[model samples]
Target chain A: MMTARAAFAAVAFAALALPASAITVVVADGAPEIALRVGATGGTISQVSFAVAAATAGTGTLILGTTNAAAGSAQAPNFGTACAGNNVRIWARARSTAFSPRTATLTVNGSGNLTSGANTIPLTNFGWVTSGGTEIASGNFTGSPTQALLSFGTTREVSVCKRFQFLNTTIYPSGTYTGQVTYSLQMP
Target chain B: MNPTRLLASLALGAAILATAGPVHAEQPATDTTAPFAVNARLNFRLTYPRFLRFRVGATGATVNLMSFTVPAGNVGSGTPVAPTGGDAGGGTGVNVLVYGNNGQVTITATNSSGGLGIGTATASDGRINYNQISSVSSSGQLPAPVLTNAGGTTALPTLNSTLVTQRTAVWTYSYLNQTIPSAGTYGGTNASRGGRVTYTATMP
Candidate 1:
């Protein structure tokens, strides 16, 4: 007959053989584990408003906020430790037992154009630059459904901050234009 | 194999797996599938206020001067007199620019006096009505605002009423020379002598 210790050993071996399957993606403090989703509300939103006092005569100027702040003031997330005073932070991680060189990719896509009632501005007008940890370099929103932001190897964790900017090249209708974008992290 | 050794191996393996599982489960959600994916969203917003900018002659604080000299033989002979100075570099034309991000824009020309006064002469002493000055535009996109003794406003013909309005054109000025009068430099150094026409643009 099998002793108690042998039976326990069998169960322990079974547990060890189980596979690891979990990916973590967090914006600020909001948890996006299972499906890994983050959005423009609660702790995930990053917004800025531009108010121009005079119209430009020649080349267009950068969209500035109060005191001509280039990217506006940074906002603190509701839950996570805030990044630098000028950036929005993003955190992500992927864990698996499959292999040592698993690939993890991050992509961003906008919800069409920014709109204020009947007026609209192209999503491409928005761009960003990132820093700290694994960086995604700098790029503009392409308005594509799956524009790659960055990619990394398996069992990696990234905690980066991004600063957003607006290119005020063309004058659209005078109103508050708003939009949202989703940043997705996938691992295989 | 010895029972003690087998049990020890199983316990050790279980301990390692438990540690890894808790690490993954402690932070975010965990799945049992391959090619796992997650997403996070960010919102953006921009508020732009109504703005308008208009320029005529020159784009500075100092007003421009457009002088016209009628030859003795051409005076009152219905000969159109071109202007000198101003932004046109001795030519009769000056650049005009109008830009606004709201609805249609209206441009008006207003002068302090009803006509060009000659040496403190009263209206009965023969003055040149502002109507004698006419302007022709190089493009319809920014037609010249009409000049009159009573002052008038003209709404810009925008390509789209709901979109931004930005137009540029060259406005060439000419003296109609339609009537002869006892003149002594009808308008000169004095601002009240029709030497300046204030152009104002308004938008809603």
Candidate 2:
């Protein structure tokens, strides 16, 4: 017959060795939800403007005017303001109680080129530079359906500042050109 | 240990292994036990305003002066006489550029006075008609807008029908020595003497 101490040790060992149960208990409390927020008011859209000014000399290239003021959150590296004059604020968080090796990925995709009336500027003309977060590669839109932005380990949070720019090498028609992009966060 | 007590200890060990941290009961939570995705959207917009830039003779606010001198033997010869100093083209030709984002662009010339009057001189000295000053563009892309004493407007042909308007050319100015009048400087610094011809460009 096994002693009391031996029985207790066996019980503990069995408890640790048992496989994770398929049954999951879901609670109404909010604790470990992945979240992605942008701009000051997380739910609202972020708008930017690039007003072009006259070229310095006749027949000279046009210059891109001053961009709109920064509207990002007051996170570190750009506390209370953007790292650059035209940066947009971004916040991402992923909280999970899963075992080790948990990872979360973030990605972005655009609908299409920015359009104004019959004129359109290629989506590739828009690009971004980042600061104050896990450094994602800086690049221009590839006109593709989707592109990867960055990835991080789960149960972690990061804040990023993205400065957007328009390539002004070619002169375009006078009007407002608009477009949209969706950001997604996935965990496994 | 008693059998009941040992059974209770085993149950506690199993409970400890299965339980997670306390869950706050305030807000809704998402169960990430399985692979899942959450999405947030960002909308982008950009605004650009209309602009039109036109240059003739010289650039900037500096107005160029074109002066022509005809020899006494060549009076009324109807010969084209080039000026002395104005643009890079020895005062005869100057760079011209018309750039705008709108559709078609129209260029017009207007002078305050009816004709080039003899500076501070009476009508007896005679006035020179603006028609004496003529211009021809180097390229058909930007045809020379008519320059007349009464002023006129001309629409430039679009290079690309689907895109904005951008035209560049060299405009060569000449004085048609057609007639002889009372001796005097026909136009000078005096604004009333029609010394300046304002070139205005408009787009819709």
Candidate 3:
């Protein structure tokens, strides 16, 4: 009877053997992600102008410049897309166009996005910074060009198109005659 | 099976008992975790002026002054002022700094944050321009500023220690820049002017 009992336990253990080929499957949310390129491309100016540079004997003039130009591209809106997008906008401001005050009329032209209703927006960021302090550019993103009907006061860097232009003079004074205002726009 | 039956099945029961034994532990293994990272970062602030302003005194003034750091970091030997275009002037030698060089000195930047490592290494050279401006007239003022590269070049800084110290090393220098005053509304006399310098620090 005892032998029979032992034999029954052995049979039960053999019946409990599990399968070896089956694989357990699991499901869960993977990992987190981040984006590096978040902003749009194109015009990056709100205003543009010129300055005295200095009261030098031979006064000099400046030509509007663009950054990220398409390598060997030419003309006003020749700037290359460091990254691409259609949102281009720009603007120009002035201090005074008077030659003596070291000012000049600044004409701006660029590609990309522009004004919806009007083609131009004038600037008043001319003259010495302390003389007339103003915020030249802001909230710039994709398309639009700015023009300065006022004066290009001192020797300053103007945000023309999507780059900076350094206008200067020295015949008159050695101090920095900074004047200029330009803005840019692009997809944020 | 009964204990007696199991023992009878053993081939060398007496030998097994003589050669083998069972040992068990009462306690479980405790978790000992370690800290590790794939990458680290250094944290610090870059505080410097956008533009430096200097005064060209009535009489030519000379003191320790600075200049803008060039696009490549060429210690301004005598380059155009900032905003390199428009009216002001270039080659007028107004923003030139006559440096008293002392060779390239060693500079180090360290990050005490996560990495506890050196962030960047740089070299500082000592030199300043002492410019003498002769004219400030309208037609072509700044008569003629003579720049004599004065002061001996500085020597390289000692960097025997590692940059992990968590600080920055900057080589201090002195240079002179001059400006011939414009014919004033007051007197027919001419005065001298001075300049200022500024720089920014970056690390990787």
Best by DockQ: 1
lDDT of 1 by residue, B85-203 (tens): 66863567888877787788878777766544232335555677777788888888787777777764474746444768878788899988888877567666577765567788888
Query: Mind giving the per-residue lDDT tens digits that candidate 1 earns over A1-188?
Result: 56988999977875553322112232222222222323122332445454544555223666532211212222222123434445555555555444345666777875478899988888787776654434567668888988987776545455555666677766777788787776777766
**Candidate 2, superposed: residue stretches over 4 Å from native:** A1-45, A49-71, A74-86, A90-111, A117-119, A129-159, A166-175, A183-188, B1-40, B57-59, B71-79, B84-91, B115-125, B157-163, B178-184
Report every candidate's CA lDDT. 0.62, 0.63, 0.23
Interface RMSD of each: 5.5, 5.0, 21.7
TM-score of each: 0.67, 0.59, 0.14
Q: Per-residue lDDT tens digits of candidate 2, residues B1-204?
A: 999999999999988875533221211123355565655555556565577778887877767777778888887899978976667576778888887777788788887566453333566777777778888888787877777777644747464445476778888888898988667776655668775677788888
Model 2 alpha-carbon miss at residue A20, Å: 39
Model 3: per-residue Cα lDDT over A23-140, one tens digit each:
1111121121111010122222112222322222112343222223331121122112131111112222122123423322332222231121322112211111110112233222
* lDDT ranking of the models: 2, 1, 3
Q: Give the alpha carbon lDDT tens digit for every residue of B103-153 in model 3.
A: 222222221212211111111211122332112322221112222223112
The fraction of reference interface contacts (C-alpha pairs within 8 A across chains A and B) present in each candidate is: 0.61, 0.56, 0.00
Error of 2 at B182 (Å): 5.3
Candidates 1 and 2: which is better by lDDT? 2
* Candidate 3 chain A least-lDDT 10 residues: A30-39
Which residue pairs in candidate 2 collide? A74-A80
